[model samples]
Target: MLGPAERAWCVVVPHQPRGARMARHRLSTELVGTIRPGLLADVVAVLAELVGNSVRHAAPLPGEVIRVAWRHRLDGDHDIVQVRVTDGGGGAVPRLRPTDLDSLDGRGLHIVAALATRWGSDRDGLGQSVWAEFRAPAARLPGPDGDDPAPNDLLATR
Candidate 1:
């Protein structure tokens, strides 16, 4: 859910495969800065794939924008991070059907499907946002002797 004033943030993505310097930005950093590196990588991979799909498929109109946003929630004891990538193209339907192995395209959504715990789309006849959610890793406990361990060492054993 985004307010009208905040919608400008959605205009940064390039609608078509070709463009003149399409821009991109991340609207959420709360979990981005807090999640484990490995888990964060997963989130980023999906986000990139979704954004790339928008740029490749969504035909951009003149002076249009593509925006991205994210929100976090708790699913049972696990953390759920939801990411959305939106563009100004018409609500073009996207499918994840199988393609030739030699084709380089059509794999983006497939990757999202395999990685996201859940995913969907939201359309307003103008454009849509492809959203995906991932379960966060278990919370790390403080180290012995009342010290905070390095992020890289949180699950590593010496």
Candidate 2:
């Protein structure tokens, strides 16, 4: 289960060509050094796909904007990152499309699926939201010399 640090970041950006870039930059800034580097990259990539799809296919929300939200928390021994993008309802439901070599597009959700531990979409009264969740490896802290070392007792000539 998610721990107490449930506060999430939600940003509203112009639902236009640049929205995806804005979302990626903001999310990367917010999450840097907090999660694993590979996990951070995956999160940013998923955010880009979600925001890009919204801009390309969906309508803007009530004020010509879309909502992007993300949160990360330590759950037990590992970290979990959740990202969501909400847009005015219009486009067809998102799914992993089968793509071949000649396909120029339709691989966004596939990437999301492959990277995220789990993902899905939902609709509310105002709009639709697509979300993905990633489980990061257990946090690793440095030892006294700033490097992880085998426990002293285990290293004692057993």
If scored against the real structure, what TM-score would every candidate get?
0.67, 0.84
The lDDT of each candidate is 0.61, 0.81
Query: Considering only N, C-alpha and C atoms within 3 Å, which residue pairs clash in candidate 1?
Result: 10-66, 10-67, 11-65, 11-66, 12-66
- Compose the digit string of candidate 2's lDDT tens values, residues 1-158: 43354437899988987998999999988877566688889999999999999988899998999999998766655677899999996668888889998999988899999999999999998699999999866445454567753322111212
What's the distance in Å from true for residue 145, model 2?
9.0
Model 1 residue 131 lDDT? 86
Model 1, range 1-158, lDDT digits (tens) per residue?
A: 73221121233554543321232225334344455566666777787777777776675434655666665543444556677877765455766878788997778888888889988888766567678888865445467766765544433422
In model 1, the runs with Cα more than 4 Å from the true position are 1-33, 141-158
lDDT of 1: 0.61
Residue-level error in angstroms, candidate 2, position 136: 1.6
RMSD in Å for all candidates:
7.5, 6.4
